[model samples]
Target: MTADDHALALALADAAGAAIRPFFRGAWSEERKADRSFVTEADRAAEAAMRALIEAHRPADGIIGEEYGTRNEGAGRQWVLDPIDGTTSFIAGRAIFGTLIALVQDGWPVLGVIDQPIAQERWVGRIGEGTTFNGRPAATRPLKDLSDAVLGTTTPHQFAGDDVDAFMGVARAVAESKIIYGGDCYNYGLVASGHIDCVIEAGLKLHDFAALVPVVEGAGGMMSDWMGNPLDAGSDGRVIALGDPARLDDILDAMS
Candidate 1:
């Protein structure tokens, strides 16, 4: 994508942020989907706004959103969106929730944004370009050792079956005092901005993580599936994020 396309992506994220801001800290209807996860009117409205923007500017590009289903399925270039990545946190009146937007071309992520509408902070990243936090360059801190790493996850409860054991086993290797819980997509932004060292979680869909790849990686962190494979359209739901790329083998081994 060119500079103009990148700017368009960011603008779409801004629109999504605007669509969700009014619903935050305000009463709104919520419902449970077939998977028993919560969804809100804000989620739907935010996605709708994003979709509208994308359709208007890039009519041929496809879209895969959390609230709305996929469209233009065969289009090689597609946008993956999660209007409210941390709905649980959003509902609880926390500022850690975010809207995730990613552009995938030929099944590879080329651009991504994590926007916290309430806090008015946004992280933008793209292939071969470094990440930027609110338009300033963002970079992660180097990891000296696994034991000193600051770890984060939205919640361990979302881990299912062997995932719980996999995630906890990795956590045990890091300093217990440095672990943080319940920060949704905010945790990934923290990784990009040098606040967190790692984030591991399971059961994520494509939209749940596609938007995070560039932001984390462009900031000098490495994001991948638990097997230490680079993330792409086909990755399994389990994910591991490390601020330092050299720690990928250690993290994967710990989880295994």
Candidate 2:
């Protein structure tokens, strides 16, 4: 992606953040979806705002969003968006929720942005360019051993059937005291910022994981599914992120 593409990604994130900020901590109506996920007017408004901006600025680019479905499916350039990634947290009035924006060219992610409107913090990343927190460079902290690594997940309940057993096997391999929970997308950002060492979770959708690839990789981390495959639109929902590339095989082994 070009420098302008990176800027456009950030602008889309900013627009979504602006649309959602007004509803934060304020009274808003919400309803549960068939998948048991929550959605609110804030989510719709933010996504609509982003879609309008993209339509106006990049008319040819396709769009995929959480609140709304896909559009212009075969366009070579597509933007993936999750206007309010952690709606459960957002409704609970927690600032850990954020907006996710990614630009996928030819089915490969090339740029990403994770923006926390309440905290006023954003991470922008692109292929070949290191990630930046706010405006300064950001990179992960390297840890070679699982015993010393800090681990995180949004919720253990997300795992079901065989996934629970597989996830626990990997969890037990790490220090029990170091396993933290409930950060949603914030945990991934923390991994990129070097504040966390690893994040593993299951049952994520394309919109949930697509925007995260470039941000984590750009910050010198490795992100993939449990089978050690690189994540893409067609990847399985299971995911593992290692801040230190050297730990990839070990973590994958533990999951296996």
Per-residue lDDT over 67-150 for candidate 2, one digit per residue giving the tens place of the 0 to 100 score? 888989999999999999899999999999989998988877888888999999898878788999999999999896888889
Query: Each candidate's TM vs. the true structure?
Result: 0.97, 0.98
Q: Write the per-residue lDDT of candidate 1 for residues 123-231, one digit (tens) a residue.
A: 9999899999999999999988889899999887889888888888878999889899989899999999999999998888989999899999999998998888888
Computed on alpha carbons, the lDDT of every model, listed in order, comes to: 0.91, 0.89
Q: For each candidate, C-alpha RMSD in Å? A: 1.0, 0.9
Query: Could you tell me the C-alpha RMSD of candidate 1 in Å?
Result: 1.0
TM-score between model 2 and native: 0.98
What's the true lDDT of residue 171 in model 1? Answer: 87
Can you tell me which runs of candidate 1 are displaced by over 4 Å?
Answer: none
Q: Candidate 2 — worst ten consecutive residues by lDDT sum?
A: 1-10
